[model samples]
Target: MATIQSQHKWRFFRSGGFDQVALDSAADLQHLSELDPKLWTVLNCPTTGLEFDCRTLALLDLDGDGQIRVPEILAAVRWSCERVLDAEIMFKAPGLPLSAIDDQDAEGANLKAAALRVLEITGKTEADPLQVTDLADMTLLFSPHHFNGDGVVMAELTSDTELAQLITEIIQTQGGQLDRSGGLGIHGDSLNAFYQQAAAVVDWHAAADPADPLFCPLGDKTVEAVAAFEAVKAKVDDFFVRCQLAAFDNRAAEALNPAVAVYDVLSNKAISSSDKDVAALPLAAIAAGQSLPLGEGINPAWASAMSQFKLLVVDPLVGSKSKSKAGHLTADQWQQICDQLEPWRSWQAAKPDTTLHQLELERLQAIVAGDGKERLEALIAQDLAASTFADNVDAVERLVRYQRDLVTLLRNFVSLSDFYQRKHKAIFQIGTLYLDQRSCELVLKVSDMARHATMAPFSGCYLVYCTCERQGETPLQIVAALTAGDVDELMVPGRNGVFYDSQGRDWRAMVTKVVAQPVSIGQAFWSPYKRVAAFIETQLQKFAASRDKDIEAKTTTGVTAAATPASTPAATAAVAGFDIAKFAGIFAALGLAVGAIGTALAAMIAGLFSLVWWQIPLVMAAVLLLISGPSMLMAFLTLRRRNLGPLLDANGWAVNTRAKINVPFGAALTGLARLPAGAKRSVADPFAEKKRPWGSLLILLLVAVAAAVFWWFKLN
Candidate 1:
């Protein structure tokens, strides 16, 4: 309940049954913060599903929370106003004039420069105003080879071949980030990580010098030797264990060796030296205290592995000592070979986890020794320097969008002027729905029909929820408020209509649900009569159907009796004859009932005609009021209380005021069918259905007879 300050002199206009602060001038926008939040038409609105520009809404949603609140709106207004020389430019559309920026402010000066740069890149002159579309492609403003202030350093930005190669390698190995210019590149953080990892790889590789025989027993061939030895290490160990078991018990040799049944199974298949089944056998034959044969006698499955092991291991360890040793490796010699490569195994286990391991050790040392890291850091720093300019350029685009959309949002959000004035549609008024011989302009996009219907009834307006469909587009649900038309044709579900969206795209709309409420006082006045007439018609139809069934049954019974041959005339008379007394009694009862009804009608007519002419009309009016008065009163009250708050609140808007849609405003929202003014018409029709006058003549005859009977009784 904070009052407006006297110095600001705030202007107010009443709409939606409440006072709304009118943002009439630039000063109003500047002093918007001073306006109390309670007076604002809307406290908050969702970012999506609105007819307004989503981009502008996103910019105004400073916290990226998918909603724009009062505070965010004020912040956006203040920021845009401070950057521009004239705050009035915000009310303009299509573009922002570059010269209008307040160059005295540092941020505004940067924006001006960025705006000029944008125009220059788009092949426009300085006199031209920069538009949001002109800055659509940011690559035009920032080249991949130049510093774009994104802190990412692309290889193309460097001139030195070595520095460029270093950047390219880092991107390929460490995975680069996306730059503002759309190229993948690194920043200062990635550059430092790359060097730190490279240093670890260099130090890890330094521990395994080739000249040191302990780690590299075979020098450059040690890596290949390790691979060869590992392949048959387990199989060779199994063979030696089998030999030791044979020495323990000579009878155990037969059981330790491959059974004869295994050889029989291998014999059936086309076995190779690499056959998996054959490889499962021992590397060599088992015997008491036997050395593993390095040549010729090894199993075919393990022959290749044994040859590599002997060439790399046996030749190096045995070292040309007399050809009499016979190319066989003792168990102790195998142990020596495994022990020789232990240091290399430990070094491999300690290797650093880095992508830099793919690079040569010498290249890594060279990069660490030189100033390549420093140069890369300098390039990254250069890119970061232009970050302020890039940020302002982005800000310039936001301001341009704000210029065209901000005030429009203010009008809709703060005061609903756009809706009340009827000059333009409000942000929530999605489209017009043409259905049931009427056009509805107050339609909202419904996300969930059932959920919306639950709260929509509280709005006190007749709503038609339709599922709108178009080819290749998802079916959209929308609720249209029918404020001006009758509900007879609109109350039914599955009724089809055409919906034209804000973009004028036509969708075939089908009514999925209807919230039945009074649309107008005229409709309400006749509702009672319509209901009574409908009830009478339904009862008449049922009565006629039952009478028709009875007549058919009677005719069938008579035909059967006539077709049957009676034994005598007496039997026939007994079967079909009518009694005179019964006929007299039936006629008398019918006469009495008709006379009683006639008497009641005559009495009512006599009573009606006893009054004076004025009294007669007054009596008739009182009767009419007794029937239709309650209906019209209820409708009037409901229509007067038709608030737009609940409908929008259901769609995720915090409407603060009682935004009423009264009778006059409701009538404007929904348009009824009518002929245009000054149009010619033909009352006579050649093809029209012929009307019979007999029904009217009958009604007149009945009224005249009742009148005469009443007069005759009065004269007596």
Candidate 2:
């Protein structure tokens, strides 16, 4: 029988010492021969669908880059995946036993090998995602790390070393160590039940009991806790005082992520279960077949605080915890919940070097019985029996030893995962900080290029206006100069734009909203809205100065005096603060107004040339309003929805914003009337252009009235 010859190729496979060794060109293609000869024949055989061999390697090396990147080798790899790899490297492997080749066992082996293979490919050398247990841990320890927004913890407090230390101490002091991995139960034993027991044990110290004197010594600890808490507060005060900018360094979040992730992973059941499958299985299948819900089960309020949170809802209509929808909290509610959850997440984010993938190894081992090494050895011995020399002890030993090498692999897998989780957090944080700081810095640098924000140029300014928007449904806003352009863009809803540079990042706000036409600072004082009215007042004051001081004073006094009547509750109630009765009342009044307007419009149309268009609601509304008297109920109702901001501000509170409303056109006027003194101009009138079609209403009313009049006229 002729021995099948190996071919030359260029490839980098890791040596035992963890060094890259070039093989294909320098040596021979033994990677294939390492499997069974029959399987190899079937793969490369003419009759089989799988094709290509050494020539395939040549095709990969044709490029000047001189290395076979992932894309270049895909064709051969894809063919290999279909049947070749399984035939040779797997089922026909020289050392594998016939019994182990049975469908069930082979299935398990295939699954495990797939898991291991995934790690070999696609994973980055610098920081492997699969290697890291808690990517945040590695991220925090690495350099160029910066603080991003925050985690579940009070970032402002946690960023302070003193507060962090105090928190660490407080948790340690309060939280008795839980033996998370200590006990294992067989059969139907519930882990959640065990956790509950553990919880009880931990809280036992906090419970008040006459027989239990744990509370006797609580006095001393309270004082100490107070002192520690105070000390932490002091440090926070100093950090705030020392901060030169709006927020802490961006990398600060990166540093915290590791700790946060640790707690999160440890507390998270889904992530841990996903990690369990990693140790026993091969990388490829483990990764491809399953995805981890890491930190997914975090407390909703706390999870909401976490930026990574994704809301999942089951049948929200039905009552099921897991089936709940994402709950959107108000800004205040969001802040309140986030404040509570941040600390818990911060504590969880810090554990382990291995990632969810690596942790799965332990989990798989625990489930299948025995550790990773035991599983690998059993697999190797079982497969070696499939060889033609299945009865030979020597071959069996060699195969067993070969498969045992998996221990080294398993160890490295754990370490690498550990590194990634740690570093990922730090890197993410740093990236965040860099973006925020750089955005502001870039804008400052570009001011000269920006043409000195006059009203015209300012109106076009879409960037630098993205603030915490009242609603995500709306676009980012800006105080634009109407003089810059037509100001049409400012009036439309969602007329917002984001600015991006050559690189897509830190998109600055570029929203535009025209509040007023240009005016002097003096004229604004006599105007209703300050910024616009003040500028007018400023210019008019200069002109009026030569004319008469008394007239100027009178104008200013008239403006000031006009404001007093508006301060009353009646005016406040005139806004959209209307109740059920009021809402209906306003609609009724509006209905009558439109009826009158429609009548007048129809009359004008009739008078125009004997051809009438009675569809006009405006003229009908005017006519109806004139015929029907006032609706005191609607007037009373409109007063209830008076703007919340003005209500709060008038009681010695500064609204402290140039906020606008998202009320519809007609509602915009009502909204504007309700605006607090601190409310920004460009405040929309509730009833701006949002007029619904009156044709339908006109038809309905006209049809009823015309029929009645016609019947009466016919009878006469």
Number of the predicted model whose lDDT against the real structure is largest = 1
TM-score of 1: 0.76
- lDDT of every model, 2 decimals: 0.86, 0.30
Backbone clash numbers for all candidates listed: 0, 138
Best by TM-score: 1
TM-score of each: 0.76, 0.15
Cα deviation in Å at residue 380, candidate 1? Answer: 1.3
- Model 1 lDDT tens row, 503-533: 9999999998888888888998999999999
Q: State the local distance difference test value for candidate 2.
A: 0.30
* lDDT at 215, model 2: 27
lDDT of 2 by residue, 138-208 (tens): 22221221212111121122244543342233233233221111211111122223223333433432243
Write down the worst ten-residue block by lDDT for model 1: 316-325
